[model samples]
Target: MDCEEARFGLYALLDDELEVSKNLEILSHLEGCPTCHRELELDMRVKSLVQAQLAAPAPSPELWNRIVRRIDQEAEVARRPSGGVAKWWPTAAALRMVWGAPAIVLVLSFSLWILHAGQVPSPFVEELVQEHRGSVTRKRGPVDLPATDPAEIVRHFRAEVPPSSPVPLLAQEGARLVGGSLCHVGEAKGLRFTYEVGLGRIVSLFQMPRPTRALPFWPRLGPRYIAQSQGPGVLVWGDARFLYGLVGELPQEDLQRLASRMKGI
Candidate 1:
């Protein structure tokens, strides 16, 4: 299979929706192509992350009945005799009838199920977790632009990341500044800073502009919000200017201590 075909079948392969023969073909292609393999790996990780975080509730019998009734009504409309504008009514009006209420209810039900599961991790936290894992596991070091001085690193980011969010020099005792990198936290441009504490433990600090709307679901940590149990650990906070997130494998208390230090910076 070519790259395009492999990519097209990737989701089906991950979800086990493909036939045995098709799955084998894609798998073979992925094994031989490093780029396709990485893409598949990233897709699987994202799906796992989303499924782990979001809860899917079983659709109620009444909801199913309602959807069936809506479909039946549309079918009846389609079978009706055509006259004047009524000729176009079956094609256009039936579609609106089928999709309007039933589609909305299905979407709403799914949304409620996700919301009911637990606190939803923000996109920023998701990106931080992925970056943290990548940094720790990769054979090479993490930083793209290396520097000891936080100011110099911030300067580099300002020139690189658009809209220029401030990269705070986190004041945590024993935490040595490693360097920084330009990255994306969700759709917004941001900067990531790596720090080392005792025993060569790594902590990542991510900063981006505050999103237009605040997320109401995330758990609060003092003034900041936290997305825990998603991966490693992440603490998020922000003000009028920028949103800041700290991620690491450190204990919750330890991460909180690090976040608290940043509050004064």
Candidate 2:
């Protein structure tokens, strides 16, 4: 299967709803395509998160009592004969409305939660991670621009890529630049800087325009900075003009250190 075909059936494949033959084809495609594989992984993570949230703890006894009382009232109404209506069975419409309202409310609440979740750092971090994974797996030729000098990369981006902030050049020990490229996540257009840390490990940092409102999360390392793991090691922080997300597979401690040293733009 090609990328488009594989993506089309990704959800079905994840939920094991696809036929065996089609599933096998998509699996084969994912095994060879890092980009598609990353997308599948991301969908799986999101599905699992939603499931966990929906599988909320049992309601309190008082809450259960309230629900049972409501159900009992519905049952009584269903049993009572009204006008020409028989009591043998309730009308499908009434049954659905009475029984489905709670579930409908629950689903709506979950949807709103997902919407808010997509608003800031978590979803944004996932977007950066996908971009980083793409960069890691993309083929590179010898003719590509050199990336050893962080300053040169910064200058290049500033001069050539309009409407971008100065990408931070890590001054930490044993860190080296591994080139950069113009990239976008949703409506935010920016630059992606790849780097090689100890033992050839790769990390990528994405810089984009600062969001109008900041909704930060933990482990709150600073007043304006917050970091969290989402399928990879992700550290998100922002300045007055731009937001940055550093993504990699390095230990969170190591990632935090690298992020902390990201000063002086």
Candidate 3:
């Protein structure tokens, strides 16, 4: 990766959002290329220091009030009764302004918030999870990522993941080691890992190596975020180099802890 992309990756790696391919790329380069590696190390140091000084708690009630008020104002427009001229148009316009405006504002504001949210990068990962609730209900379709023995799963991953490395997968204790597989990433032709959890939960994970097209920092399509429209609560984040995304509804914190456990959280 070049300096500019490497710089964005450094932050993504620090936040643990870098994609696996990117993770391997930056990390591999760091081993052979000293300059980029050193820069990444420095970025991590700064990221930790900044995170440490974060406010102890979320915004206080007073702050929330101000925030909400400002948001409301940005979305608010006086609605007038359309008694004469094109009666339908006025009501339609009012509805459009009411719903459409807030939706647009929220989308834009969220984009700004996510650009720097660190631990959470993609805003719609949650939306993807919400939509995936249906597939679970059906018991069919979606990529058939079945489970297998951990030993066998390891071999499969090693064969598929280029540069072949050991990607950890420690499902709940007592749970069967099912299996794991590499799936086509998104439109980017990248790759991701999917593990069929105990009985129900399925764990899908991957990292962004680099950005190619004019996709959002967080690549997604239509109802699909990271090219996935259905799945449990999928988590996406990055550090200095790679972008990471995990799909599963298993408790948010649990998922985070699981991810942390897989690598060096």
Candidate 3's TM-score reads 0.34
Report the Cα lDDT for residue 2, model 2.
82
Regions of model 1 farther than 4 Å from truth: 1-143, 161-164, 218-222, 263-265
The lDDT-based order of candidates, best leading, equals: 1, 2, 3
RMSD of each: 15.9, 16.8, 20.3
Can you write out model 2's per-residue Cα lDDT over 162-190, one digit (the tens) per residue? 53456677767877675676665665666
Pairing residues by index, what is the TM-score of model 2?
A: 0.44
Q: Rate the local accuracy (lDDT) of all candidates.
A: 0.72, 0.71, 0.54
Q: Per-prediction count of colliding residue pairs?
A: 0, 0, 35
- Which candidate number maximizes TM-score? 1
Clashing pairs in 2: none
lDDT of 2 at 218: 46
TM-scores, all models, native as reference: 0.47, 0.44, 0.34
* RMSD, candidate 2, Å: 16.8
